[model samples]
Target chain A: MYKGIAASRGIGIGSICRIIEHDLTFEARQITDTAAEKQRFREAVEAFVQETTAMAADIRKRIGPKEAEILEGHIVMIMDPSMSGEMEKMIDAGQCAETALTAVCDMFYGMFSSMNDDMMRQRASDIADVKVSVLKKLLGIEDVDISKVAPGTVLVCRDLTPSMTSQIVGGNVAGIITEIGGKTSHSAILARALEIPAVLSVPGIVDAVKDKDTAVIDGTEGEVYINPEGDILARFVLKREEFIRKQAELNSFIGKETLTADGQKVELFCNIGTPKDARKALECDGEGIGLFRSEFLFMDNTRLPSEDEQYEAYREAAQIMGGKTVIIRTLDIGGDKDIPYLKMQKEDNPFLGYRAVRYCLGNPDIYKTQLKAILRASAHGHVKIMIPLVTTVDEVRGVKSLVEELKKELDAEGKAYDKNIQVGCMIETASASLIADLLAKEADFFSIGTNDLTQYTMSVDRGNPNVAYLYSAFQPAVLRSIKNIIECANKAHIPVGMCGEAAADPLMIPLLMAFGLDEYSVNPVLVLTARCIISKWTRAEACELSDRILAMDTEAEIVAALKIAAKE
Target chain B: MVSKKMTIKNEQGMHMRPASLLSQKATAFTCSVKINYSGNSYDCKSIMFLMAACIKCGSDIELVCDGPDEEKALNDISEFIESGMGD
Candidate 1:
């Protein structure tokens, strides 16, 4: 059993089809006829451009413009006289066209691959992609057309680019197994978007399984069983069938109110990073957006987004929700999110260092620009500003004052905005949870960012693989902090919600429900699953179970109890 | 010859898109354009050479242009760099 990240939800049992990336190799023979070689190189370039242009159009038509833009870049690279000119000059220097092209491309690729920036490093792959396509044209080799893949085939490859993933979709691919890629890698995201079961980051998986080998992939459990024994195969086949049935059943819960068995309604919201994700939230029947991470706007670009750029993004999200609450978090940079333009000092422990609300509060110009933009977007639809990593009442007060100042500025400028726009704070840090009552008085609502809360409370770096085993949301200390915050919010008479991976976990659902969490914000893909889980349980029983589980001393005890309770 | 200093404004620096754009513009001119950064000069008409230079964000590079249409090439390339290659 190969354990990897379960990127998508579902079970897929299919014959494995390994995709060995074609590495082009050629002999370097001296060319006496420079003119003919140059002409040949030009012909190859022309063919490459024509092919990429057609592919771009097809991708645009099949997928969308954003993905097609990758192919469009290749077209520009092929047409760039600098690249082709270098190749032509080499041809004129008594070198074969293939040798020249390879040398020039390798030079460019080497530079790109050595870059410190992730985006720039990805450009190296882009250059390599163009090189392969051009080489194929020159060698008369057919491109790997994943679109023509046989249905129900599990695609096994080293890795997949967004362009390759787009082709794999609608090609009847049952599952995807990649040897490299994290949960947030392009292939994983594409797998989730395509709703195909995916197991990623399984080292040497391509070599372990041969072509036409029957494989069973459990995306939810992050396990891949290759050519399993008779009993295991039979069990997996049954599991796959049951999973399909459960998926169909979950679809029935769509459009249905997220209510407990006793008719206690709980708001089901979605967490989104980009404005484009708002559509996915809507499709999942999310009641609102609990956390619209604003950092993506800052992190994806070279510089901070202007007020207008931020406004358009926020407005698009607000307009899409159509009065449904959209909780737009302020720019939560620093920590794991390093924006180079910010020029933040490298810290020994970044997670506990100057990050989130601290960074925004320090940079007033950056903070106000985003504040003004979110407030401007409020005029379009329902928009609330939520501050992240707040550990003090003073921080909440500070942000409120900034919002007040921005509101007055907007009013003076004759710009209309939601005068009653609500403000909230994330109860993620231990200090924030402890002082929840003080914050609840100033803030309109509270959303527990459990990921950080767990990290901070346990004093564990969740990203550290060494200590990752101790990073559990069900840990007694983390649960105690959550319980304390919920109780504090209840005392203050403000609704409390959770916007973290914990909220989406089926095992944690009952505990959070029992704690009387008014809202549950999760990834859009988990909305229906969460709803179904909520619909099946009574709030009172969940509360009772939560109370019992909270009394447990260890995570193992809580897990055992949860399993028993879940079975009951 | 006309030389002007410009800072790379795009977050990604002189990446493929910006390199291609600059190279395309430079080739359109009869002038020879050289970009000098960190004490090294690269042919501005070669995208491969420009990309290999790895001019990151906030780097100040000098654009030197000579021959007929030198002024036009320098002005256009300067404007493109300043615009952050339409980031």
Candidate 2:
């Protein structure tokens, strides 16, 4: 069995078809006629453009225009004067067409590959793809057309280039395995767009499997089996059916209101990092933006983001959410997430010191810039301020006072904003849970950050291997803390939400529902799945189960009881 | 020749989308369009050059245009940059 990064969900059992790397090796020779050599290179480029244009149109029709833009970007990049003009210069100076193309491409590949940015590094791969395609066109090489592949063919390749992925006929290819790429790579993105199961970054995968070999890929588990024994195959076949059935069941919940079996309605939202992800939240049917992490505005910039720049980012998210609640967390910097420009001193216990609301309160000017941005954005939609890692009631009061001051400034400047904008605290620390009732009184709302809540409640550093066993949210202490936080918010008559991995856990959903969680904020992809889980039990039913589980003293006991009570 | 200095207003700076748009816009002019950033001049008509320049948000850059329609080119490109390059 081979393990790989699970790029897409589902199980795929099919016959393998390996796309071997092409041999574009050519000899560099002096060209007698520079004009003819340049013409040859130009013709290859023109042919590449024509073919790519057709493929882009097909992808735009089948998958989406956004995916097609990758191919279109190839067109723009290849035609750039810095690219083609340099190649023309080499060709004019007596280099062969192939040599000239390779030289220019190699120069760009080096420049992009050596960059520190991930996006620029991705461009390096893109340039490699373009070079191969144009080189193949020049060499008169014919590719094994993916469109012509038989149904149920599992394509194994070194990597799926954008042009290669564009040729994939829907429903013909069952799965894809590649030696390179991760969840965010182009190959993975294309596979998800095509609704095909894929396992990527499997070392030696192409060399391991032969053509026509029967392969079973559990993309959800990132596991692969070649020529699997009878029992294993049967088990996977059953699992595949079950996955498909569950997917169909989840699809039925899309465009429908999130409700419990006994008719208790709740909001299903998404936790996003960037403003652009708001569109994905809408696409996934998320009702609102529950936790819009504002750190991206600072992290992605070399220096502090201007108030207007931050406002634009927040406003873009607000506009995309279309008046839905967008709870923007103030810059949660310092600790493990340090911005060099901020000049944070190194600390022994970074996570416990100078983080989130603590750091924001220390740097009043930076905090005000972010607060002002969120305030300006509230005019466009239902924007709220959320303070992260709150350990004291004073943190909430500090942020609220800052918001009030910023509101007056905006009012004086004739800038519009939501007057009733909410300022909330994230109940992540043990102290926050202990004073949840007090914090709830001062704050407009509460969001339980279960990941850190569990870490702090159990005193288990998630990064420390020795105490990793105590990091589960299913721990009795963590569960009690969560229940108390939600109850405090309920008593204060303010809405409470969970914006952590636990929110999407099927086993924890009932417990959260029983605790009267008003919102469930999960990764955008899990919106429908979470809604499906939420709809399984009524408040009374969840509360009844919770009563029995809450009596358990051990984490294992609690987990076992919840698993037996799991609705899905 | 005509030139104007301004800060890049787009949050993501000169990424692929904005760079492509800027290049396409610059290619439409009859004048030569260039952006001078950190003592380096980049052709505004080339997406590669623009991206390679890495003119991030908050970074100040000078837009220079020269030729038959230098004034119009400078004004048009400057306005586009001012509008955050349609980010």
Candidate 3:
């Protein structure tokens, strides 16, 4: 059994289909006519650009603009004069076109790889992608299109690039097993978006599993069984049927209102990063967008987005939601999310340093621009602003004052906007949870960012592998913090919602129901599953179970109690 | 000859987008345009040269143009930089 991170939930049984990456090696030979070599390079680049542009258009129509933008980035790289100019200079010095391209691309790749910034370093992979595409064009190599693969085949690869994943159309692939990538990797995200079974970070998986070997992948369990015995294969076949049946059953809950057995209504929403994702959220029958991450708008661009640009994006999402509440979070950058334009200083401990609301508070111009955009978008649909990483009531007040000021500015300028746009605070930090009542009074609503709340309450860095085991939302301390936040919001008569990974967890859903959570905002794919889980339990029984589970001290004991409660 | 000093306001500095834009603009002129940053100068028509200069955000650089259209080239390039290269 090969253990890995279960990136997307599903069961896949199929014959292994290895993804053979073409070796990107070329023979270096000096060319006599430098101008001819330069022309050859230019032609290849132009062709590659044209090809990628067409691919981008197809991807835009099929997947969405965000995924299509990856291909657009490739076109930019091809058109980049720095790369082509360097190649021209090298060719002028009597080097072959392939050799010149390789040397120049490798230099940039090395520079990107050595960078301290994670996002910048990831650009190295993108450079490699460009190199491969151009090199393939030059060498007349054909790409192995995944869409051409037989249905029910498990794809085994070292890593999948955006280009490769884009070719996986028409449900041709059954499962994906990669040697590298965590839960947040590109492949994992794409797999989840495509609703494909995927197991990632399985070391030596490509080497261990041969082509055409029967493999059973349990994405939920994070296990891959290669060449299983007769009995095991038979058991997995039965399990696969059951999994399919369960998924069909969950689909039935999609258009239905999310309610407990006793008829207590709970809003099930989706958390989206981009405006394009609102379509997926709607398809999953989300009540609304609980957490619309606004940082992606800043991160994907080369410069600060104009107010018009931000307004257009927000308006599109609002129009799609069609009066459904779209809770958009303000620029939550800093710490892990570094924007080159912002020029934020590096900190020893970024998580606790100047980030999120702190950064917004300091840069009033940037913050106000986003606020104005959100306010303008509110005129189109149900839009609410949610401030992230608030630890003090002062921050909430400061944001409120800014929103009021922006609203007045819009009104004075005769620009149309929603007069009564709601504002909320994300109860993520321990301090925020402790003073939730105070925040509740100032804000229209409260959404528990359980991922951060768990990290803060447990005093564990969730990203650090050394202490990742301790970063559990079910921890007694974390659970207590969640309970306190919910109770405080309840006392203040403000609706409390959860917009974190924990909200999607089946084990935590009943406990949250017990706490009287008004909403559950999770990934779009989990909307139906979460609704299904909520429909199975009565709020009264969940409240009773919460009391029993809260009395437990250890994680194992709490888990044991949950198992018994689940059977009920 | 015409020359102007401008700071790179774009967050990503002289990355591929701005470098391409600047080079394309320079190629349209009849003048020899060069960018000087941190005591080093590079031809503005070469995208690789501009990007390789590694001019980051907030870094001030000088654009010098010589021959016909030098004044127009200098003004247009400066304007492009000031506009954050359309970001």
Q: Mind giving the per-residue lDDT tens digits that candidate 2 earns over A505-566? A: 99999999999999999999999989999988999999999999899999999999999889
RMSD of 2: 3.1
Give the better candidate number (2 or 3) by lDDT. Answer: 2
User: Which scores greater on TM-score, model 2 or model 3?
Assistant: 2
- The digit string of per-residue lDDT tens for model 1 on A406-505 reads 9999999999999999999999999998888788899999999999999998899877799998999999988888888888888888889999999988
**Top-DockQ structure, candidate number:** 2
Candidate 2 chain A: minimum summed lDDT over ten consecutive residues — where?
Answer: A115-124
Q: Which stretches of candidate 1 lie over 4 Å from their true place?
A: A1-12, A15-36, A116-121, A142-227, A242-266, A270-289, A292-382, A387-402, A409-417, A428-441, A451-495, A523-532, A538-559, B1-87
Every candidate's DockQ is 0.35, 0.48, 0.26
Q: Give per-residue lDDT, candidate 3, residue A355.
A: 96
Selected candidate, larger TM-score, 1 vs 2? 2
| lDDT, model 1 | 0.86
DockQ score for model 3, please? 0.26
Tell me the spans in candidate 3 whose CA falls farther than 4 Å from its real position. A1-11, A19-27, A30-54, A84-94, A133-147, A157-169, A177-210, A216-225, A230-265, A268-516, A521-529, A537-562, B1-87
